[model samples]
Target chain A: MRNIIVTGGSRGLGLGIAERLATDGFQVIAIARSQTEVFDAAAQRVKAAGRGALQFHAADLADIEAIPALVKAIRKEFGALYGLVNNAGLGTGGLLSGMNDAAMAQLLRLNIHSPIALTKYVTRTMMTQKGGRIVNISSIVASNGFNALSVYSATKAALVGFTKSLARELGPLEITVNAVAPGFVDTELTSGLGEAGYDKIVRRSALRRMAEVEDVGSAVAFLFSDGARNITGTVVTVDAGNTA
Target chain B: MTSRMADNTEPSVRSTILDEIHRIAALHNKQLAPLTDALPLMESGLDSLCVAVLVASLDDALELDPFAEDENLAFPVTLGDFIQLYENAAA
Candidate 1:
């Protein structure tokens, strides 16, 4: 079976992507800080598909020094890897003047730096195998300048830029690289927005509603499928036409 | 960059890439380190922005894209492999 790794897989969009791939016939390695109910729900999805298995590894993706060793362990256990979803990220909000260097540093490290480092190692192995896929979970905030999200937007924008170029570099190997930019989904990350804030976002969207987690997960699953062979270096936004 | 390939082209290209590498490393605030063929490019302390710039510069200068055709290429891990990639493309 093909092996795939999903960072931030315990909850949010990462769990959705992991479960979707599992049901679609790929073994998934879920990495997150801790196990969650969503992770167990992912297992049920895998079982419903009648094939593939789910494994969880709890790690702080922010602790990037351990990534190489994590990759080695995954290789020893699952053999060859064909997919990687760099979905691990944190959202920070504050006025530019109020934001401290430490907060900016943490946001940059987790959102932008760690994924690229992980991708570097994973891409090397994929090259040896002659093919693979990489999908980065970017945010619509990267494109639209959201209030109080200046630093967060900057980091996400960087990820989008990296995805576009790396796709070109890896195209020769049939290893596609892409990013999925989701707008407001009803995930825990957005819960802090409160009901009024949530409704305001939904009204702004052309579709008049926030997206379900499945919408973004399905997009990720499509990128990994055979039909998406020619798609690369682009962002698939799954925000109910919110960005439109 | 407009110069034609010549006997001196390889060395000039190598040094130019080296200069760009140093520029990028410093831009990212990474500690200056020695550049050697065996030094891992990622671990050389260049971040994604730095690596992306270096790769794009090589593409513009060399103009031989191994990824453009049916050519099969391995991912370059070290400085040597990256330079060798352009060298192989040139050949």
Candidate 2:
């Protein structure tokens, strides 16, 4: 079975992707702080698959210093990781003047630094094996540039750049790096915004509705599939045509 | 200590949890406002890092596993909401 590691697979888009991958017969190892919930969800996904298994690990993605150790642990547990989805991230919004250094640092650590480090760590393994797939969860704000999410957008934009560069570097090794930028996915992260907030977002979107978490999950699954072997370094937008 | 002694001290723990929530809120550049017991944490604009920090701090201050389970404890939007979770866990 092909083994994969999905960071932040406890809930939201990560969980959705994990579920889809599990159903597709991949050995899914989900990494999240809430091990119990993540494992439970993974268990359900594996059961739904009927041909795959799931493993859960508890780790804080914001602990950038621990990323190497995390990859090592995955190596020990899974032997070979076939795919990695950098889905763990946080969205903090404030004017540059309003955010303190610590807040900004925290955002960068989780959203940018950790993903970069994890990608590098995983790429080494993938390169040795000469095969793997990597999907980064970016945001529409990466290109659209929202007002309150300047820092968040920049971090994601950096991921897009990293994806393209890494794709070029790793193309010969048969490793593809791509990003999926979801527009207004309905997940716990955005659930805080009530109906009024949803309406506002929908109004701005060409599709007149926000993308479901599953929408992004399907796109991520496609990138990992054999069909996407020739496609790399591309940012696939699943944002309901908001960026159109 | 007897039941009465513990009962008398309950409010102190509650107060401490409230203070910690406010501290965390301030760290996120949010003002400490009157929060209800059921307000969702994200509604107040506390992002994921703040939630992680709050969980870590609660773990240390209360000396209990606040996230003993993986259930999403709705972000505490109000000081009271934060206190209630601590009180429940500490109890």
Candidate 3:
């Protein structure tokens, strides 16, 4: 039973990823600040089937300084960590010029600093084990620009670079790192856009439909599978050809 | 070595540092000669990535990272200097 940590796994795309991995027989430690009723139900269903285990770990990932101790505690309880899904992030969409400095700082802290700090400690365990998988949840907007998402897009773009360089650095240890770039996933993160906003996005996509949370989940699952053992340092786009 | 020993009485810190270096070297498939206090880390065949893994691994084992403590501290050039950083910080 491999231990996989899925940050922000209480809901949204993170929940989808957690459920998918758990169903695939991976012991998932879902880290989120709070647990949702939906998340609890899903964990129950997954565990009842005896497919895999889902354990929730409440944490405020934005507290970057506490990450090392957090990682240490996770490892102490769960043993060697086999995978990490750096999916916890804040989607702060706003015009850069009007964005408050404090808001920008908070956005950067959660979206950028948290994951990197989390990864730093997690990779130590991976390095010691000589193998692991890392999947970063990036955004399609990282490559394709969007209105009012300048800061959000930049943060996601940073992950792309982080994924590539980290893949290179940890490659010698047989640890593979990759990013999953999803486009217009229908989750709480995008609910703020409302129906008309989604309609516009759906029409723009080649598939004429927004990508599902499960689509991103499956992509992440693939990266962790044996089939993707040789695939690293690249972005696997799950955007229904939105960029095409 | 004197600088490291001066800060702390424990002799095991030196051995722990050596062990981690060798462990990380093996993980990265880098062959290293038996280390001497004056051996240049770069010449020991461990690249920057390997050295990074070593520092991280040491921090995990020893629970402190001297380099991370002070941004202004010069990077250790020799094996002894590297161990001394940990010792001084631990002290």
Candidate 4:
């Protein structure tokens, strides 16, 4: 079975993606600082159902310098990484003026630097193996923009460029790179909006409902599937037409 | 620690660069002409992406990238100059 790495897989959308991919029969190695009970349960579900296995590894992705070693160690544990989900990121929302220097620095480090550095090492393995998939978890706010998310949006927007350029760079090796831009999903990441805020968003969406974490997960899984082999250098927006 | 040996001799460093050029070429399905010290990297059949992979892999193997530390360093054009850059950095 092909091995995949899902960063931030302890909870939220990352865990959802891990569960979905494991259920779809890809050995998923979920990298997070700590494993959650919810993540453990999902892993158990996949295993008990005789689906692909879901396992966990610990890493602080914010430390960009340590990423090369981290990728090396993970590759040693799980042979020939077939896919990477750059899902670990901070959604610290704040207006650009009020955001302190430290907060801005922290946001850039985790949101932008970590994924790019991680991809650098991961793609080495992929380039050698001659085929792989990379799905970067982007936010719908990246394109449409949102209140109090100027810096966050910029970081996510950077991933769109990262995804497109990397897709072109690695295309010759048969590696596919894509991004999934999800609208406000029902995760803790969006819980800050609370029920009323989500309801307001739901009313605005053409679907008249907020997207579930599973929807984002399915989009990522689809990209890793054979059906998306030819799909590269594009952003797969999963916002349920909220942007539409 | 493995790179410590390359610090002892420039030839060993050159050998590492040559081996990596071959490995990267094969991985990308590019056919490289026989390597020589005078061969320009551009003529080696490895495109920019492959050259990037080669540089990154060498940095990992040697644990030192002179180019990363010095922005003003002249970009190496020949296969020999690339190996020398790493050897000098290791020294």
Candidate 5:
């Protein structure tokens, strides 16, 4: 009954990870604002696997103020969390000159600030417990820049930096903090890009296709597994050789 | 959900909060569609963090605590709903 929290678990990569973790026999507490569908899906997967219970929590990650309270609630309900997956993020795209200052600010708040706050809160609990795994869902754009993805990339880059630094800070406590930088996964976010746009992205990848959400999930699960206990402060790129 | 308070239309308090919401929402590329009532907040693409940013911006502009309690607050799905919330707080 190891407790885990997967933020943005309503769909896409987060839901994929939640489903896999549930099947692996870990009690999963999913966090999302409108995640009823995600919960139903994850529950069915868990039941089919005949392992672990699933709990869904609804919260807006954009509300940075609500994060500490949310973490506290999880601690109260589940005791001590064994793993945390900071997969909740938002995408905002526009030319730099045309983008408004407030949009940039909000993007940073959701993509960077929320994850940092959650990591800070959860790290404290993990410190006291003397064991935990943290996997941050970063973007491939963090390494390779794109035209309209400046703000989004910046936030994810900050996340990668945070992951490395926090790993150092918490490694002595036996808590591993790492990041999974996925390249163009098939999800709601990509669906919004439409067929032509998606094809362009896929062709740019070395594999000539988009990585499935579960591909990223398997990488995240590996990082959280006992075999990865010695791996920390690293960015595992599950980009299907896109960076190579 | 029209009210005498919302209709008062003074730049004093309520209007300032409404203006801030519109400004923030627009910055997020959200449509201020149907600046009237009856929009669900969760569907507007304005998540919890947007609300916090809106509150902070409102605090800076209006210098008040319109976001006093979370219990009484409703997620604003539309421009009108946000304006109504601001008006209720002002009242």
Candidate 6:
């Protein structure tokens, strides 16, 4: 059976991606810092689907040193990796000037360093087998500039560059690397926007609404399927035409 | 060649791979040096971008992955080695 790893799979977009992939029959291993109620329910649902296995590992992604061990555990259980989604990331927005050193460091660690290290470890496995799919969760801020997300945007943008370069390097094998850039989504991250902020976003968007988690999740699931076999090194915008 | 072996498919895996190489190079407007067993691919005008597309297209047609199950794989450096890489896996 093919195996996939979705980081930050306990909630929001990560959970959505995990559920869709599970429904599609790919064994999913979700790595979240904690096991929340939603995660347990989703795990049960996926297992009940009986199409594939569902497992969740609790670990802090920011602890980069723990990555190798996590990969080892995945190999022990799943044998090989068919897909990896670097969906574990932080969402922070503030003017660069106001951002403190610690916050910037933390953001970089979670947003970029951890994913790159995980990708490195997973690619080592992918190289030894049929290639796999890597979908890095990015944001519209990665492409377009935003007022308070200077550092956050920079981190997201870094993944775009990394995706393209790695896609070419791994093309000879079975693997493909791509990114899904989502605009504002109605997850807990955006829940703070409240009525007025959401109204502004809805009005400015071409689709007249914020994205749901499934919207981004579906895009990720596509990249892992044969339909997107020929797609690589490209950022698929999942935002409601906001980035369009 | 035995009749039993000939029934697998037409064009053979070897020719298929060669055709794909030429096709990819042509599609990308890359001027690969004259095909040869000893020609180094790096100097053959096949840029990194071209190689990426070539590998993906070839992988689509020929599913054999030489590097699979072995990370220490000495990746093919020449046209012959590259062809042999897939052929070895197929065998």
The candidate scoring highest on DockQ is 3
Clashing pairs in 2: B41-B75
The TM-score ranking, best first, is: 3, 4, 6, 1, 5, 2
Greater lDDT among 2 and 3 belongs to 3
Question: Which window of 10 residues has the lowest lDDT sum in candidate 2 chain A?
Answer: A121-130
Report the C-alpha lDDT of model 4 over B1-91, residue by residue, as the tens digit: 1233545754467767777788888777899977887889889898888887787677656666677579799889998788788888888
Question: Which 10-residue window of candidate 1 chain A scores lowest in summed lDDT?
Answer: A121-130
Residue A18's lDDT within candidate 1 is: 86
In model 3, which residue pairs have backbone atoms overlapping below 3 Å?
Answer: none
Residue A90 accuracy (lDDT) in model 5: 85
Task: For residues A108-208, write the lDDT of model 4, one tens digit per residue.
Answer: 99999999989988987777567899999998988996999999999999999999999988998899999999999988888899778888899889998
DockQ of each: 0.04, 0.01, 0.52, 0.35, 0.02, 0.05
True contacts kept of 5: 0.00
- lDDT scores for all predictions? 0.82, 0.78, 0.89, 0.88, 0.78, 0.82
TM-score, candidate 4, is: 0.88
lDDT of 1 at A212: 86
Model 3 chain A weakest lDDT span, ten residues long: A121-130
In the range B1-91, model 5's lDDT, one tens digit per residue, is: 1123556764656556556657767655666544445656555555554555565555445544444456576456666667666666667
Regions of model 2 farther than 4 Å from truth: A36-39, B1-91
All candidates: TM-score: 0.73, 0.70, 0.92, 0.88, 0.71, 0.73
- Please give the clash total of every predicted structure, in order: 0, 1, 0, 0, 6, 4
TM-score of each candidate's B chain against the true B chain: 0.69, 0.61, 0.84, 0.83, 0.55, 0.78
Residue A97 C-alpha lDDT in model 5: 92
Scored against the true structure, residue A229 in model 1 reaches a CA lDDT of: 95
Q: Report lDDT (Cα) of residue B65, candidate 4.
A: 62
Candidate 4, pairs of clashing residues? none
The superposed Cα distance between candidate 1 and the true structure at residue B29, in angstroms, equals 39
Using TM-score as the yardstick, the better of models 3 and 5 is 3
